[model samples]
Each structure stands twice: as structure tokens, then as C-alpha cells.
Target chain A: MTGRVPEGLRELLAQAAGEGHAPWRTLLKAGDWALLLMAALLVAASYPLLWRGGVADRAIVKRDGQLVTELALNTPRKYEVVGAIGTTVIEVQPGRARVLSDPGPRQYCVQQGWLTRANAVAICAPNHVTLQLSGRSGQNGAYDTLNY
Target chain B: MAPMTPSTIELPVTADDYRIARYAAAAIALTVAETALPSPLPGIKPGLANIIVLVVLARYGWRDAAWVSLLRVVAGSLVIGQFLAPGFFLALAGALCSLAVLALAQYLPPRFFGPVSASVLAAFAHIGGQIVLARLWLVPHDGVFYLLPLFATAALVFGAINGLVAARLLDLPAVAPAEAAA
Candidate 1:
């Protein structure tokens, strides 16, 4: 037996049942509206966190996992660091740094493009050298470091 | 014909048992199949098996749905040879969180709350649980949170699709027992 359902709701349900349509599509209940709003809000709130970008002021270079050099990013210059495998050329431009050349066969380090953000890093595994950017204003406003 | 006696009779299986078994098997199959596909990112999958769980939850209630989901995770992991592994634990965590969310979401008025909303909430909860567990046990680093945005986006997209699929399936008339037997 049908309970004391509203006429409008009963008719909508009947139509949905007859046509094999999802009833929620036709008439959204208050709960569904609330959930939809919440989902939208969540997506909007996370956009800034994911896409935050800032300029870096310091560039740190490491060789064989040891700190070898640290440079101020304010000056534009190209420098080279010799590692066990070969030499790695680093290019610094204002607030960004990148690998101009690397001895690795694949040149993956050169392919890393640039490191302008505070936590950005580039590595030449074959030459055993790494370049990372950091600065007081470079932080993404998130966690300090990532494990995985 | 000889008259049948109580001693010669066999107990008939309940309809609920049959339905549960069918849905659980489907879920398990989906889970195993999903593992074979290559994923672009770690700990991310379409989670298509969740559609079955949602349908069961809508039709049979949360307890039966939970049973189906638990069976799927256990049997599916065993079939894929990932039982007791880190991957298995992550999957289990996601499933438990999703089920818990579904259970709570069911309290909303039926008119406004349906498979889509439930699926979305469940998906987010699933990801949240996995990330928390990963931080505590797997990665143990703050960096894991960096992947949250990617995981959250995946959940939103997949959750909406799965919810729609579940909604379509739920709209169908119940299968006749005679047809099911065939």
C-alpha cells in the first residue's frame, strides 16, 4: 500500500519507475543538493593548494649526495660541476635554475626543464649530481617535504 | 508418485542468499579485472567494483552491502596474490572507509540522497582513509599529501560515473526468480 507520499513526489516516482530513469535526476532531494554543494566547495577550496607557484631565491647543488655548492639565485650565470661520471652544466636565470647540459646518455636532467619553485629539484643520476631550489618566499605553503 | 516426507525434503536457499552471492561474485570479478589494467598513478583505479556495492546497499541494506564489499576485497586480493601486502591493506582501508560513509549517508532523506551522492562521499572517504594510512605506515612522510589533489580529482570523476551506473541498474525492475534460476 502507498503511504501518505506527496502527490508530486508520487507522480515523479511513478514516472521514473515506468521509464527506468533515475528519480534523482528529475527531482533532487534536499540532501542531494547539500552534497552537491559540498563537493563543489571542496574542489574550489583545493585548487589554490594544488597550483600555488612562487619564485625561488637560492640554488643548492649536491655531488654524490654531499653538499658541494650553494648559489644566490639573484644573479644570472651558467656554472659547471664535475662529478665522477662527467660534468653537469647548471644555468641560473634570476629566480630559476635548470640543467643546461648533463653527461647522462638519456639527458634526463636536461629534460627536467626548470626549477623555479622553492621545492623543485633536478638530478643527473649518471653524473651523481643534483640541483634544488629554495628561498624564504619559495614555499608552496603546504608541507615542508614529501616522502613519496 | 510416492508421497514426500519431511525427512526427504531439502532446505530451500533464501532469495537474499542468492542475491548476495551473485552480487559478491560480480564485485570480486570486477576487482580482479581492475588489477590487470595499468594505472598511470599509484594507488589510483577506477574502482568500478564499487558500483555493485552501491547497488546492493540501495536494494538489500548496508549490512548486506558491507558483506558483499568485504568478500570482494578479500577474495579479489587472494585471486590477485596481493593478500596481506601493502596494496591489499590500502584496498581494505579504502573499502572500509567507503562502507562507513555509505552507512552514515543512508540516514539522509531518500528523496534527496541517492547512489550518486553516496558514491561521491564514499569515494572521498576512501581516498582520505588511504592517504592517512599511507602517511602512518607506507610512506611516513608529509610528501604523500602532495598527491591528495590528484587522488581527490580521480575520486570525484570516478565516483560520479559509478554512481550513475548504479542509479541506472537500481532503476531496473527486480529480476524474476524463474529468470534468475535459468
Candidate 2:
């Protein structure tokens, strides 16, 4: 491997390890900033969930590794649940829901209460289980093509 | 097709000329690195060429810096066949936001912050701009919070990497300068 590295090897090395830069786009003009801003603003405006109702995919409920059959989203608007193990109804408040567990006083789940559609979450930290209400990805025109 | 020389006719530069040739070479190299690098998923690149941009910005003015960024976006996008896709838009937004940050960083005296801080600041702004764009013309989701932590983590990691590269590039011998002077 003196001065002349094999011609093919040298060519390969040059192509593979060469430095790079780019060309000019002397034509790109900044015109769509305002429209993009407006669209973002529109989405941000609906954040309070006062006017537009959120539709999360089916909410599943379980207790102690067993499906809680009784508790179900019976109707589009109605909701109810029941459990046999360590389950107790704390209370339901407007714009929120809650549950009380005998696990500990820290009660991170209870403190994380009254979550609306925008802030959909579930915490059964003690049972090592969680249920999350996901917003519609299929219904909205947000997607052009499914990854599948 | 023969590779064209730099745009300026007034200053003719050959392939052997260190200045123009080196920039052209760096552009192609960065473009390949950006497109070929695997990400967590497809259409996801870390904008790694930003290190080169920060270096160019330091050595040259805003104009050349902008050109390098523009070239990377265009040539890189074309090379990867994502020129007109949504991915292109994301890269374009990142480039523009970076240019904005680099231009702003110019005002401050080269004191406490260097390329790393500049790159990090630009990365933060880059994410913000992309999120804003995605929420608007692209997909809509209440899942922004779900992605916030992930993007934030990525920024911290990638931003440091960019800053490090920028610093490294700054130290490398300037083998070539850019043509069209931008």
C-alpha cells in the first residue's frame, strides 16, 4: 500500500469518503408563514374543550388483571365501571373523574384527577396497569396515508 | 452530466481549487450522511449537516451560511427522493429556523456561548417550528404532549451532537471555501 492505493480501491474510497456540500434554491420565497400560523392558532384555540367534544377510542377498564365486564362505555355519552379488588368510587366531578385506592397516602392517581378529553390519561399505578384514552387518528383528516 | 462549477462567473474556481471544490465536496458528503443514516423510523433525520452550517456561518457571512443550508436541503432532499414530500417541508423549516438562529447569534459578541449553544438554541427553535407546522398543514393530534418529552430528549441529545460537530468542524483545516461567496 504505497503511494497508489489500488485504482478501484482509491475510486471507492474517494466516492465513499469524499466531503459534500449543496446547490442553490434561488427561487424559494417565504409566503406561507401567516397561513401556517393561523392553522396552528385554530387548533390552539379549541384547546379548552368547551365547544368541540373529543372522541377517544373505546375506554377499557380492568381490575387485578381481570376485565371488569360490568364497567363499560355503554353509550356514546354514558360511562360506568365496577371492580372486585381494592376498588372504591371516590367521586366524579364536572370535567373530571377520580378513584381512591388503599395503596398509600401519596395517591398520585387521585391527585391526577378530573382529566378532560384534551388531557386524557389513566393511572392504576399500584396494579401496574394503565388505560389511556387516545384521540381519533383515523377520523380526522390529519393523516394522508396509514403507515400500514 | 458534468458537475457544474460554482455559480459566480466573475470568480472561476476549478475542481482542484481548495475553496469551491471543498464546499461542493462537503455539501455532497453531508447530504449523503444525512439521508443514509438510519433513524428510529424512516423520514426522520437529525439535521446533522447543521454542524457544517454553524462552521460556515462562523467563517463566512449569513449569505453563504444560508446557501450551504439551502444546498443541503435541496440536494439532500433530491438525493433521498423526498424533495416535494412532507419530509422536505420539515427539513426546509429546520433550515430556515437555523438560519434565523444563526443570524440572531451574530449580534451577540462571541463570549459565553459558542457553536454548541447556538446549535442547541437553533434545535429548540427547530422543533418548535416543525411542531407548529405539523399541527397546522399536516396531521392534527391532542397527542402533542405524548411527543413533547420524546422530542425534548432528542433535542438535548442531538443538539449536543450538533454543537460538538460544529466545534470540530471549526477546528478542521479549511481545505476549501465556498463559491458564489454565499
Candidate 3:
């Protein structure tokens, strides 16, 4: 449809083309400043929903996306998980956990250093192992050995 | 000799077509170049090409801007060897969302809503659309939401920057209405 433009499309095109060439400032205009503020506020509001703070009370380990074991972080302990490639060693100290060693070549999980905060995770994808730390409010508390 | 019919039908090309092609080419160039820059995450990007879209929106109109933005996504992906791949769809999703937002944002009072405001709004919508698609298909986990703050921050920073660039481009005395494609 080279020349046959729909009425609605024509109107939209005209409306866009007809827009004024307004002047620009750093902040641009009143609505722009307001939008910036709103965007900041929106991002700020998402912090509570997306970010988890406070010390994690438990360390949950998974292999191949399935739960392997859950250990309390109150007691320092060393745990081993047999994974796709080899065993992954996880160390849990009071309120925190870390990957002591992993068979994965990259050692990304080992480099992660620590998972002290709630919802912290160390994933060794090559070994199909994942270690996640959870606080009292963390979602991982939904099921456990005691509950089962 | 009854009739000498041309093998191909010639469609009349308008000035808008040439202008749009030029704008789309510029946008695609930016997209391809931006890919060379290192990113902190796999998906998060500065979206520098959006500046061209903002300029097209202000100078040409929403229709031309939409054409330019979409053509950039498709052609850019093809140039980068990502056509019809996961990355292509993500780019397309972002472009569509931003265009939808810009369509409505255009109606707002120009006195209050200018290029910067439109840029910021489109940026947010762009990320939002990508996140939704990523969550549904790629990652398939709620953990995707964890990236919201980071992506949102990128959108705000890059969106405003692109908008400011567009504003400056619009203000240049040399920039006039699109001349018929040479």
C-alpha cells in the first residue's frame, strides 16, 4: 500500500510530524523532572521487593536445579556435594557460606568469596551445583528435613 | 511488438522513504558499534542507538521514528549475526515497548513533556519488556526480577543521556527538515 495509507496511520504520522520543536534544557521540562523523580522512586521502591538484606541463617545446596541439603548457618561446617562433573565443597560459617572448592574449571563460585546476606547464591554451573544462603525471612524456609 | 512490459513493478518512492532509510541506517550503525563495548552483564546495555530514535521522533515524527527503530532492530540483528535468535527477539521486544510508550507520550503537552521525558519513559518500557520476555522464556525464574534495579538504573542514565543528545541535535541551527534523498 504505497499511496493508500490508513486513516488512523495517517493521523498518527501527521500528529508526530506536526509536533513543535520545543527548546531543551538540562532537565528539559517540568514533566521530565517529575519523571526522573518518579523513576528514581520506582527503583527505590523495588529495593524492598528485589533486594534481600540481613544475615542468612541457613545454607541450602542444590544439584542440577534440585535441592541437595539444607544446613543451619549457626554452626560452622564443611559440606560436599557430588555433581555433574565432580564434587563441590561448600563451607558454612556463622551467618554466611562460601564455596571452599569446586571441580568446575572457571571456579566462579569459589571466586564469589561469601554469601553472607539472605538470598545470596553461588552457582557452579559446570558441576551442576548451587549454594544459596537464606535468612529467617528467606523463601527457602518453606520446606526442610524437620518439616518433612 | 504488442507491449514491452517491465519485469519488475516500480513503486514510487517518496522523500519520507529516503529520510527514513537514512535514519534507520544511522541507528543500525550505532547498534552495531555499541555491541563492541564491554557490558557489565549479558543483557544490560547503554542503548546508545536510542538517541537516533529520539532524534527521529522529534524531527520526523512517531511514524518515522517507529520505522527507524524497528528497522534498526531487525537490520542490526542481521548485521550482528543474531537474526531470529534469542537476542533478536529481545531487541524487538524492547523496540516495540518503547515505541508503544512513545506513541502515548507524544500526546502529552510539549511544554512539559519533551525529548528527555520521552526518552526516559521509553527506556523504562524497553527494559520492562525485555525483562518480561526473559523471565518467561530465557531464565524462567523469579530471580530475573533481581536485575530490575540494575537495569532500571541503566535505563535512567542512558535514556537521559540519549535524550540530551537528541535535544542538542535538534537545537543545531544547521538541522532543517529532511531534504529529498539525494
lDDT winner among the candidates? 3
Q: Number of the top candidate by TM-score? A: 3
Model 1 regions more than 4 Å off: A1-24, A27-30, A50-148, B1-15, B176-182
lDDT of 3 by residue, B7-126 (tens): 486777797886787777777777887999999987788787788788788876899999999999999999999999999999899999999999998888988877888899999999
What stretches of model 3 exceed 4 Å from their correct place? A1-27, A53-148, B1-7, B174-177, B180-182
lDDT ranking from best candidate downward: 3, 1, 2
Worst 10 residues of 3 chain B by lDDT: B173-182
DockQ, cand. 2: 0.04
Q: Is candidate 2 or candidate 3 better by TM-score?
A: 3
Which interface RMSD does candidate 1 score?
Answer: 10.9
Q: Clashing pairs in model 1?
A: A29-B112, A146-B143
Poorly placed runs, candidate 2 (over 4 Å): A1-148, B1-25, B41-44, B172-182
TM-score of chain A of each: 0.59, 0.36, 0.58
Writing each residue's lDDT as its tens digit, candidate 2 over A1-148 gives 5343432223324443446522111111122223223434544554433234344433434455555532222132333334333443433332233443424346665566544452254566564433333334435423232111
Provide the overall lDDT of each model, using Cα atoms, as 2-decimal numbers.
0.78, 0.53, 0.79
Q: Identify the leading candidate in terms of DockQ.
A: 3
Better of 1 and 2 by lDDT: 1
Task: For residue A100, give model 1's deviation from the true position in Å.
Answer: 37
DockQ of 3: 0.20
Worst 10 residues of 2 chain A by lDDT: A23-32
